[model samples]
Target: MDDQDILMVSEAQIAESFDADGLMLKPLTLFIKTEHPDVIERELSVLGFFSISTSTTPEKTPMYEFTLSPLNT
Candidate 1:
């Protein structure tokens, strides 16, 4: 994969909020430029993220949205 195909997540890119139940929620929005977005989705699932939605940018780049919460919550 070229450098442009690699997805990088910065600390500032991660957003945290609390649900109504006071559960901490981490939401992520990733615009995948790679041809195989499933690989990225699987990786995120391994990290405990739940797939929220999947879409595409105006340019047709795959876009994935995910959310993660504490296992206890």
Candidate 2:
């Protein structure tokens, strides 16, 4: 995603969403908005890097939430 499509979520909000386990790294959640949600979804799905979920604002604006975590190899 480009800089324009990304919305920065606050550190406090991220901390609140996740539990702390000092030994482990935290997952990152990205909030992305785009005119073509389907295209973005398809692209991300092809990459197979993130766990994606979708939602829409009250005004029917599409938002994509992508969560990335360390993979256990």
lDDT of 2 at 44: 68
Listed in order, each prediction's TM-score against the native is: 0.47, 0.46
Model 1 Cα lDDT, one tens digit per residue, 1-73: 3435545455454544545665546555555566666676677668653544455556645443333444543
Error of 1 at 45 (Å): 1.0
Clashing pairs in 2: none
Best by lDDT: 2
* RMSD (CA, angstroms), candidate 1: 5.2
Q: State the lDDT at 40 in candidate 2.
A: 71
Single out the weakest 10-residue window by summed lDDT for candidate 1.
60-69
Whole-structure CA lDDT of model 2: 0.60
Predicted structure 1, TM vs. truth: 0.47
Query: Candidate 2 — number of clashing residue pairs?
Result: 0
Instruction: Give each model's whole-structure lDDT.
Output: 0.53, 0.60
